[model samples]
Target: MHSNVVGGSDRIGEIIEVRGADGTPPYRVRYPDGHESLMFPGPDCVIEQGSATAAAGRR
Candidate 1:
């Protein structure tokens, strides 16, 4: 499985650094603009598993 970043969604940030927040995956996302936020992995974000994002990377 892999992570997917959707467009029109809240832009976490560029070079987004993810961590576990409250034990949640993608706990936090840091943007290049010198801003960071806590991500809720599923509710606020989702994992994308398909050919579209086959890089097997993160958001």
Candidate 2:
């Protein structure tokens, strides 16, 4: 996700849980850092779904 702060790093993660439907906020994400957070994606954030091929590559 992109950050509103200048030079804030984007994060790549798996969506572990979704608190709402219909593209809602407060999503739980497990990041590559092995930490998780309940995120409310802001205007600067861009969420991308991981492809099956990409998931396989991680293993």
Q: lDDT of all the models against the reference?
A: 0.48, 0.80
Which candidate should be chosen as best, given TM-score against the real structure?
A: 2
Expressed as tens digits, the lDDT of each residue in 1-59 for candidate 1 is: 12355444454343244466554465455565767776555555445334536434544
RMSD values, in order shown: 8.3, 2.6
- Candidate 2 off by > 4 Å: 52-59
Clashing pairs in 2: none
TM-score of each: 0.32, 0.64
Across 1-59, the per-residue lDDT of candidate 2 in tens digits comes to: 76667888766778777898886878998888889999888776777788989867875
Which regions of candidate 1 fall more than 4 Å away from where they truly are?
Answer: 1-26, 43-59
Worst 10 residues of 1 by lDDT: 8-17
Instruction: State the weakest 10-residue window (summed lDDT) of model 2.
Output: 2-11
Number of backbone collisions per candidate = 1, 0
Steric clash pairs (candidate 1): 21-27
